[model samples]
Target: MESIGTSQIKKAIHHISESVFVGLCRKVGTSQMVAMKRDVVDILEMVEYYVKTSDYYIVMLSGSCREGFRLKESDIDSMFWPNNYRVIWDLSQSHYYNTQRQTLILCDCSDSPPGFTLLYLLSPSINRGILEACIRMKNSCYISSSKYRQKICSLSSSNETEHGPCVSGAYGTLEYDNAHCLSCDFWPPSASSWIERCHSWPQPHIVDDIVNNGCHFVAIGHKLGRHEDHEWRISFSLAEQKLVYAMNHCQFLTYCLLKLFLTEIINNGLDEDDKLLCSYHMKTVVFWVIQQNTLPHWRPLNLLGCFWVCFKLVLKWVYEGVCPNFFIPDNNMFLSKIHGYKQRQLFMRLYGLYEKGLAFLLQIPSIRSYIINVLHNPKVSICTDEHTLISEAEFDETLYNEIHCFDVLYKSDIQTCMRYLHTIEQMIGSPLLTQYQVIMLQILTASLLKDTALILRMETFTCKNKLKYRADKISCHMLKVAAKFGFITDMLFIAMYYFETRRYRDALSITEMIKGKLAQPYLMYESKVDTKMYTEAVGGQSWCTKMRKAVAWDIRLYSGIHYISELVSEQQSALRKKKTILYIPSFILLYMLEVLCYRHVDTMRVQTALDDLQTLVHYDQGQLIDLRHRDISWQILGICQQLTGNHQTALY
Candidate 1:
């Protein structure tokens, strides 16, 4: 990260231009390469003028040049190469090496990162001498026309082209005896297809594209369609220089992967599929947009919140006694009997929904903190035994009515049910969960006593946590009750199940789904039964270290949402002045619900555990003076390292 000297920057520019010159002129050979000398002179003149006016210093690297290795030009470039400095120097002198001695390689870490590390990110290497990456800077390589000439010159007349066959100069066909040698062998949508697909989307002038889209210049010839001798062909291969030159100097063909989300719907304007897809896209953008440094049209919370609203409106029809989308049946599914692919699809969709909703909440850390903090609030200990939650007459009457109505109503009506349940507390001084919720709980408890999953699971635990473990024990039973003919009942739980299995890639895809979040995704992906089954009672993903604090805030906020309903309930019920304001108990019930969620999610969530780690990191507010919480941005680097099997580095 150190600032490089103006002179070294100029020399680096000159070196690349020289490589390009040498790469381009086969007949003009090393003699014609002086063409780039003009570029060097121009760059030096500019740097000389700029140097005195600017503050800059040379950055160095500390490392040994890997032994007996070569480098590819398309890799990212740096001013110095500690790993392969001599090879770098050979190129700097255009391979006419002379008058250079080996110097100790080191960098002022305070001012700059070592140069070899920079090149390694930028360069392409293969052998241990100079370990080049296999996948990094993929779009930086290009097979040039000059190289084509050299290769063709080496080929005999027996074959029309050295690449196996030349359909024309612009198009040479490689006849690989072993197709596996091709980087993209038999995939349905080949690499070239992705490039063409991207190009097919609207393209603007190069400068405009970079100015508007988030492209920081791209390597020339990498992924570009070419014409030579009036023939069009694909060039493939890149080196470190290509990465450096393209990144430093702007280019027309830089790739913009974020542009992949440009989507629109037609044919009937926002049909169910369109509605869902739009929501999906919004969620994906929410995930990526914040991670990037760009001109954001809408921040993550605004965007995610908007999507949540849209999804509610779109799916609200189902709450009114109809199942709009069977894919996310209230039970959802996982380890399901249904087709594996369908299960995966449904789970991913649900994950997306929850992620959008949860991410929106996460982005508003105050709100998330508020919601979570209430869980730690103390219960009313001073109340006398005479002051019960609600009169039994009203509790019994509401319980009777609700049970009868719930038998016929869809379970997703839980929100409306929740509102109604909250209403009782507002009217009469009663707690929802403690009274009627207890009634419902009793019914579920009796039904569960007869189920076998509970019987077997109970055997796995000691008798002590049994009642406390009911939430963990009977989700499958409740799900069975919730299920129709033969489908699983919860999308979120399926996501959780998948997560427990270390299927996070699929879980990631599912979190992008909204249908999974609200509907029964395995006991709310936060139920005690779910959390305990998943073992979230520990300070895992579920129990935010500040859980006690966040829960307190949640109850206060959630209670405020239902305050008007509660006040009207109290006024209608004609409760006494001392007992009229019953908002606090309702807040307490909500607090318990969130704690359940925290516990359940802790037990079951995965990718999000790392996500929580990130929040915890930023939560430090720099108080620790240690870089323990490396920030959420570490997710990408960690994942990338894990993918490359760099477990130690990934852990670090």
Candidate 2:
């Protein structure tokens, strides 16, 4: 019944934030954060390198994913631009252009807002879309931003809608916003002052990097600009990502906390039209606060204090009706909105919450339980006993998630596999790559090596020269390397390849060895692996070490790569839409391949293999063959039955 003081709540919030927010909750730890940042850059660079920027435009991932925050509600943000067009500040800078290859566009800033420009076509382009987007204005050709946005959106499906500069659409279960932009390597004069202001915060090296990356001209213009329909906004998104990467762990968490507060508390019950603050405005506020050095130290214990400072600044900016852009201070981010009655209402609402002080955080579901715990048992709540163990466990969870995210990020193809190998080679000697990233690289390399071997095997059937022997030898060596580096079940891919190539004896030998290994009961499974059993199986080694040699739970076959001839047509169709993956349990794939191999090499053992496969398909009860993949398991069984002339059973 006694009242809790403001400082006590602050202390409790800090402890809770350190425990809940920093590890598994929305906040990613320092190592995971570094890995996330590196992973995005590497993937984007790989896209550029492998695609040659010919089929798809060069892309840079923006937003929270690039900033290393893993909020569940976060949408994917990407900016892509064709490699053929180059945007320059003036005609004097056209010397770098190759007239045969590049179409030059000039940035016109005369009639636009501070952070926006009109793109003028300085040279003819072969792309009919670009030609159509250009309109003759004042005897000069300028690209119409509205027309360009329409052109970009037309390429997407009918369901995609325009959201500001981005073309928003859903890719499978995830929603994404892809902004079409033109890259400008030259830094804009409007933001020249930003370079000078970076002296205190973003070290000199970071400033150089940002300047080198320059800026992009996104499709949207200022609402009140003179040529609003033709204008494009100057985007410093790449630079902002770099600034985020430079922030300390505590500072980064404070930013994440601000985003959390915006979504969960500020916009909790408000309708879409009534909400004024967005994640962008919060990001701008944090950038200003950091550059100004308003907080001396951003330690974990003072995390609540940091969030409070940022919240008050937001309230002040709302009251003032001026939210300045970090790169261009003159460009009032809230110029058209956040004025008059709405401004007054938002400030009063925030001010009322401000009066509640740190207790306002109680509205957040993730932090509420901690606040209750602290209030009930103040002395014991902040104690270090159980929190340390919890932190360690969450740390392991973080490691596990980071390691597996590679499979989620990309599917295997010859180009992607080659690019991944190239990226891994570049990252191997780099100091910035973390140990977890290295582990991830090894796993991906192993998987992709299998893909490379399978593709080479497909190509071998067409060979008529000495190169065929070389390709065959190299393919065999790569599979050996893949098995050495990948999970225990990855060897099944090699067996599958041998079975396909009519090397039945070799394929059966691999299936026999794997069956023996899998019988030990220590192999991992999809999200269902028992940690204690796996550690015991691996001789009490750490998770990091065990993951390197972990037994494979499933045989993962990506759609784009030519894994099996029977599945080629289905895979080709699936590749055109999205990355399709088939998860066949290791035992099921082994048994299926074993049945096929036995039919080719020894007719006598065929029935035994068929009996084993049939038992797994019908009676395993989701033990060896997971029910999630039951359809595929049955399909495999049907294929085996039909192949061996059991027509009636295959139909059933």
Candidate 3:
């Protein structure tokens, strides 16, 4: 019998993995999903009616439900915003308050201003009023306010209200038709600051988009006994919803696999009281993992790989007893649950399953047979088809359109940032510009500058000469600004810009500087999860480490460096030999850069690129990289091979 080739083995693994994911999705069942959606709509309608009749203005459905990754048992999480009152931050006192309450009560303390009040007023009377109003609603539902309050009190030993055991805010359950239920929390509009606080996140543009729209902040009770702090908990549910919505078919299916793993396997055998993990936690892990990876890393065939990445993240969190909130790092979502002995138990259970690999995943009750069939009999047809896979032409077209949009968006954002900077310069001495605002302006400006440099590098080979020259000048200035702001990723682009412009010495110098910086330990200055910040401080370091492993791994960076080094060596040899060197035109230099990039486009090179990308995809378990750039790398390699008469290999 002939032995199977390596590529065939990979293809087989890919097919089997996809089949398993499809089976899991099938087990999830469309009927249950339909039921969940109908129930959610009905609940939302009811809430909308209540808000319309009452002082509340709107009801926002949030959490897993809004994120489109909900399970059958997942509770509907929502926020109610009042219409008559405007929530405002009281600078005089370090708490939030409603503007209307200022005139209702008077305080004469020296430190406290007379026209200030606590926001929401979580007193016994207020709690009772809200609870009574819910009970009076026409919907015949079971009220679990008492049980929720008791649970909150048990979680925290803070002062309780006279009406009942109270936490930081009120909690009530509205059961509908004995088949569905919604858990609602009321919060003041001022709590939106929690979302605003994520402005310092690495992806400033995405955070800006979230802020520009609206972010919800919920009133979650204190985990510990810290009562003086009534800070509202920020929820990125809206941003998450948008992110999940933008996911391609493959990513959505991968998410389903994760939910199934959490619900059917992890939570299945455990007693109700012993279950610490939930679908929400799994979703949070997925969000962080997605932020760290690129699109190619999340292909449909790699669904199991993505699931494993999320699992490892959760396992690490369990071991550390700390699952940092995706948006707010300071808020440890797992602080209360995975403590002491429980952490050890949780870690062991997950680790054991992880060691068992596909066999363990097959143990999931609902899809056990489907997974077994896919694994044992490779010939079996897996229901999950490759419909999500895009043709080469489609992929190229999509890439072109996306890059075009990115070019326009980055240019527009850069102009806006400059205008803001100019405005700040005009207001330099004015009291209106606070320290925080100044810092924010600097951050936003730095981020936009980095983006500008990145966009310029991406377009260097494609754009016209005049535009390329303009991009070069702007990129140099932007790189200096980014350096001043201590953004290292922008510096990496600076090196690439120098290379593209034929400044080999300068490019090499910048690369060396980046390497030195990458050697140092990274520290988190702010308690927010920003992708750019993480990439610059930590992710960049990891990338450098990976690049140093093999020149073939990051062909774009390392190969360019190698070519520059060789060019410099040849020039020095000519000087030593006393030979007159002919000057090359700028266009010739650019052509040389392109040739060097595509010169080694053999079958081995193409395979090496794919293997390197796959290795990088698996490295760090679930961290995200710029996969779009990786995609471009493959395209360049293919085009180079095609030009050099390796048309068949290039087509492959």
Candidate 4:
């Protein structure tokens, strides 16, 4: 450590000392939670040491007061980064073993390449060993927290509780600037350099061992009024950010894996002794292998996760050869109990993707090449009909998550095929692979997208143009392999493409192709055994006959309007909310009134509909009530008048 009195490191340490933090806040008279601990460096040093020593590098230090009520008997809140570099200064060699309480690893990631960071609070371990394991686990990956945010934008006002920004690690130190700052209200740096200064923070020089681990941050927004803000105003939502952050992290890992893997293939490479970085890495390389021909941005992160998760389940089952009992709720994906050959294929693909993602993470290029080369392996042939060859449950989820299946398959899997081709091209230093690889890549561009006009220009050149090698069709295996993913939209696109080219018969033939499989026992049902029925009516219309049709219609029109799929995305959300507003007797009244009109039964239904309308009118607010209720009531009156035909009408 640097001398306690001289260096900037000493200044940071001095700043965090209880006397420093509390004294600073007290002198400024800002009301932060009373201090629970201070000096904070012991724990910081410990965390930093482990971070630097372990494969994960990049350690950050930000001080806290109460530790957010999460302090154990002398708990030190510090974030650690452990992607893969060993930090020389890290002191956390066996620190995880000492923790006695259950640990909670709060994650904030929602999705991943500029991966989103999550706030996951790992479940507390009942005992210390479990806690140790938890810490060890946290140590195994990159770590972070919102506390790192600046403590004050500018600690100007004693109105700390009022307009003052709360203290985060960097909270007070890194405001907009002096003039713009709350305290000085002036641009600290020049006005032009304000943004630049904020972005150009100095990376800490944590000993020679630590590598920089990127951070996942919350995008803070200022709300107008102090009291009039949403719950999320104080902090980012935990659950909301998981998927995206996880995805982005996956992408980053994929980029690194490809770099590492190809580097190995080019430079003699890894021996068998290297420890696997788990399935996450391999899944990425598998994705790279699939997407080798495409740009990095084209790869899908979640599908890779899906494949990895699927693989984990299968690996668990095959090792024991016993029936596995697990349910992938998103898809009724079961491992031990696949009912058919197709299902086995589905499991294999997901498992395969999982394996590849792991390979990518661990820097296993040989594994990547091995997996990629197997695309042409005679024994492990590509499935011709995905539903008939892979589990529909697994296929549907992987295929339909966000990107189109064909686009995803090409982007995720097929590109790996071309990556192999390109890899061969790179090794031989021959230009022959270029033309074939380029044409194969065009398969990614729908033959119909206008952009393909450029791709079409280079279509004439073949592997044969270079002499020795004959560039043939992208093997029947490749097409059949992709066809099994069972993507209806892809079929639609292909059919539309043919029709666009004036090949009506071919277009029609393609439509007839997947139509039969669309209705097959979508193996997904077995996966989602606990799936609940969605509310059929908008906003849970159990008996809201006279309820707010506005909310209902708003939901119905807006919920599924954009999702092109037949299975509406909001159908589950709307059903799950099962929102019960007031008892909407209007629907019942309307039904009764309709029956009365149909069978000429002059029942009490019309009057009830009228009463329900009046109740709605009474409860609703001024203008909004008038706007919402007026039309429905007027329509009811119109219907009643029509029911009467020429009968005398009375004013309400």
lDDT of each: 0.26, 0.75, 0.47, 0.28
Tens-digit lDDT track of model 3 for 1-652:
2356867766776776767666655543232332333333433333234425443345555555555443555554554544433222323432334443321111111221111111232222233323342222123221233333343345442332322121332212321110011111222233344455543232666655655554433333334523213223334566666565555556666677777778888888688679889766877787677766633476658877777777888888998888866655555778767798888988998999979875687666656776567667878765554334322222222222222111211123344445444543554455655332333334345545665565555546488989877877887898787556533333554655566567755765665565565434331111113334434543423222322221111111211112243244444543454422312222122323334333343334434334333344335222223333333334444554555566886798
Query: Candidate 1: lDDT of 306?
Result: 32
lDDT of 2 by residue, 416-465 (tens): 66766776677667686656556666766776677777777665768776
- Residues forming the 10-long window of minimal summed lDDT in candidate 1: 61-70
Candidate 4 segments whose C-alpha is farther than 4 A from its true place? 1-211, 214-489, 521-652
Model 4 lDDT, full chain set = 0.28
Task: Evaluate residue 545 in candidate 4 and report its C-alpha lDDT on the 0 to 100 scale.
Answer: 19
Models 1 onward score TM values of: 0.16, 0.85, 0.42, 0.20
Model 2: runs farther than 4 Å from truth?
A: 1-27, 30-56, 96-101, 157-161, 268-275, 340-345, 381-397, 407-427, 430-433, 465-467, 515-522, 536-545, 551-556, 576-588, 598-652
Q: After superposition, how far is residue 55 of candidate 3 from its true place, in Å?
A: 5.0
**Whole-model alpha-carbon lDDT for candidate 2:** 0.75
Clash counts for the predictions, in order: 65, 0, 7, 99
Q: Give candidate 4's error at residue 128 in angstroms.
A: 54
At residue 129, give the lDDT of candidate 4: 22
**Per-residue accuracy of model 4 over 352-457 as CA lDDT, tens digit each:** 6456544442334323333344334424332222124323222222212211211211111233334433432343343533332232223233311211221221
lDDT of 1 by residue, 343-407 (tens): 34534554464555433333332133332332243231222122142232222222233322222
Winner by TM-score: 2
